[model samples]
Target chain A: MIKIDQLSKVFQTSNQSIQAVDHIDLQINKGEIFGMIGYSGAGKSTFIRLINRLEEPSAGSVLIDDQDITKLSKRDLRISRQEIGMIFQHFNLLWSRTVRENIAFPLEIAGLSKTERSERVDQLIQLVGLTGREDAYPAQLSGGQKQRVGIARALANNPKVLLCDEATSALDPETTDSILSLLVDINEKLGLTIILITHEMHVIQKICHNVAVMEDGRIVEQGSVLDVFSHPKQPVTKKFVEQVMGKPDNEVADDIFIQQVNSGKVLKLQFIGESTNQAFISQVAKKYDVELNILQGNIKQTQAGAYGSLYIQVTGTDEVVSQAIAYMDSTSIEVEVVAND
Target chain B: MTDLFPNVDWPDLMIATGETFYMTIVALIGALILGLLLGLLLYLTSPGGLWQNKYIHIITATFVNVFRAIPFAILIFLLFPVTIFLFGTFRGTTPAIPALIVGTAPFYGRLVEIALREIDKGVVEAAQAMGAKTSTIIFKVLLKESIPALVSGLTVTSIALVGYTAIAGMIGAGGLGDYAYFYGFTRRNFDIVFVCTVLIVIIVFIFQFIGDWMTKRLDKR
Candidate 1:
């Protein structure tokens, strides 16, 4: 478990001071994948670096398994850092070293024997699925392959907490999915507590069990992936949620067909967890005397469960449509009347 | 060839060629080691570097710049006392080495710093995050990553050292430069001067070829 208490980082410049990471507290449980999502300059990068003391906090403590890393002496901090591995967005592998040598780097720092380093490096190569490219330099590998080497190198020391600083932001969509799945595999196989910062809601929706939305050096909101996806409170959170949930409400309202709805009403329906699995749209249409047309809908799966939204046009008597909206409200689905005449 | 250059003493020319080779190789080795150390210090003490000490950076930078600014001929005369103190004389190929190394190391040191600076800062940060010590980062990350640049820098520095050696020879140090001066130019034996120039050019080319080959072989990037 990692507990960050009132962590703050203020970068002092010649002219002024900038608070890159404001006072924030977060608790991540063991064997859980926690993600922090924010736009650029939202302090997500500094926040992750603060966990491993890569960016020293101005005030507060980072307790990993009950040990305050910030308080450790330089030598002791290095010793502690061995168990808190980190990977970067640019895949900061040593270009001069081959994959095998790169994976053995941390072990070499930890003073492992030559034979022991090789044995552990081989296992790590297989774990990250870079089995055959052990002798290849980082330049010889593709972007995904380079990240796999980064991941393998990070996991070489068997760290209890793995910190990823925008680890997948540089890869393409296909490679992103592969890397995310590999992270999930590492989390399950090793039970390592993984904390990653990213701007992509798809990343959070896919693998993060819990997510914290950051804005201007503070976490605006945080919750289970499903809950956050279904009900976003802050405007910033809503924008990130819309990344995977489809167009925003204002954009949907501006749709030509939605504007042409003279008599019918446009409703935005949100489905959470098992409710997404139910045929709520079909049942709602049948239960009420209404013709439902799904204008735009997106369903995404999260580690907690699946949550999605649909923008539908329902044509029926106003009373019956209101009743249908009330019915959806009574279920796990949340409904909003986007347009009504 | 013998008929064409009747004034040329074969044994004397051979000895001069040997002295030139001796001076270039020994001074190159000294300059490489000393310059690498100085360069590492300069780099590590610069702003945003690993050590990042202002005073140390200024001191090292001042030392390097001062040495680099001095002309090789004047530098030999300036270091005459120190050369005699070390070598017990200032009139042979061995004494000339001190001036050659001092003149060339600072120049090479600047190149080393530039080469090190070209490395990705992210790679250094990555090494630090891995619990690597300062020494480990220097050897494994900084130096290892900049091998090709270092080798090329050495190649340029070695060529400069060759030129400095000839300058050192102009005063009292014995080498092809001294031979060309005494027997070729002063005695009007232009053939000896031409022969010396050819040998020096050949030495420079050899260094260039070896440096380029090693750099290409080491650089996987």
Candidate 2:
């Protein structure tokens, strides 16, 4: 478990001081994939680095497995860092070293014997699916393959925590999917506590059990994947959630829904998990005598479960439409009145 | 043929050529070691560097700049006293070693600094992230990554050293340049001067060819 308490980092320049990270506190349980999502320069990178002590914190402490990492002596810090492995977006593998050698680096640093180091490297190479490319240099590999080497190198020491710094930001869409899957596989097989920082909502939707949305050095919102996706309180979080759900222009959606129905109401219905499979919309329409026209819908299976968003135009007497919305709300679905006359 | 080249003393020319090679090789080895150490210091002390120190960086940088600005021809004459004090005599090829090193070490030091700077910052950060100590990062990451570029820099410094070794001839240092200046120019022996110039060009081409080949072999990027 990693617990960060009131952690902060401030950069003091000659002309001005920049608060790269405010006093933020967070806890990541063991064997869980926690994601921090934010735009560029939003302090997510600094927060992750603080956890590993890559960037010294200006305030607060990071406790890993009950040990105060911030207070560790220089010698102890070096030894403790062996347990925290990190991978980079650029796949910072040594261009001069082969895949086998790159994977053996941490082991060598830890003073492992030659035979043990080689054995560990072979296992990591197999684990990361780089068996045949063991002798290839980083330059010879594609972006995806390079990341695989990065993963293999990071895992060579069997670290308890793995920090991925925009690990897929440099890859193409197809390659990104493959790497994400690989991360998921590793998370399950080894139960490694993984903390990944990214700007893409899809990355969080795909693998993160919990996520934190950061804006301007502060966590604006954070919760489980289902909770945040189903109900985003912050605008930044809402924008990110909508991005993956194929956001429709609110004005256009309102105009189109209003044009279709001269009165009544237009509502957006959110269905998640088991509720998505249920015929909630049709049931509400039938029970309340409201005619429902579905304008747009998007549903995807997230790490939590099935999640969906639907825009519907409910046309009937105001009393009946209100009754229908109330009925929908009584069920597990979330109902919001977007447009009404 | 004998009449055309009457002033060409084969033994003296050969001896001068051998001394030139000895002085150039010894001085180059010393300069390379000093330059590499100073260069590493310069890089590690620069702002945002691994072991950044403002004061050390300024002092080292200023020293490198001052030395780099001095012309090799004048530098030899300026070092005459130090050379005599160190070697007990400032006249022969042996006394030229200090001047040759003083001239070329800073040149190579600057080249080393440039070569080290070319390494990606990400690579260094990755090493540090792995809990590598500063020394390990310097040798294993910084120096290892910049080998090809360093070799190319070494080649350039060496060629420059060859040029300086010739300039040492102005202070009674024996070499092809000394033979050319004293025998060929003073006695009007154009054949000797022409032969010495051709030998210097050949040596430089050889260094260039070897350096390029080594760099190509070492560079995987």
Off by over 4 Å in 2: A248-269, A275-296, A310-341, B1-6
Cα RMSD (Å) between model 1 and the true structure?
3.0
* Predicted model 2 interface RMSD: 0.9
- Scanning candidate 1 chain A in windows of ten residues, the lowest lDDT window is A270-279
lDDT tens digits by residue: candidate 1, B126-210:
8888888999999999999999999999999988977877777788688888988888888999998988888889988998999
Q: What is residue B196's positional error in candidate 2, in angstroms?
A: 0.5
Error of 2 at A277 (Å): 6.9
| Cα lDDT of model 2 by residue, A240-278, tens digit | 998897664464564654566656677877777643664
Q: What is the lDDT of candidate 1?
A: 0.89
Provide DockQ values for all models, in the order shown.
Answer: 0.73, 0.62
The window of 10 residues in a row where model 2 chain A has the poorest summed lDDT is A248-257
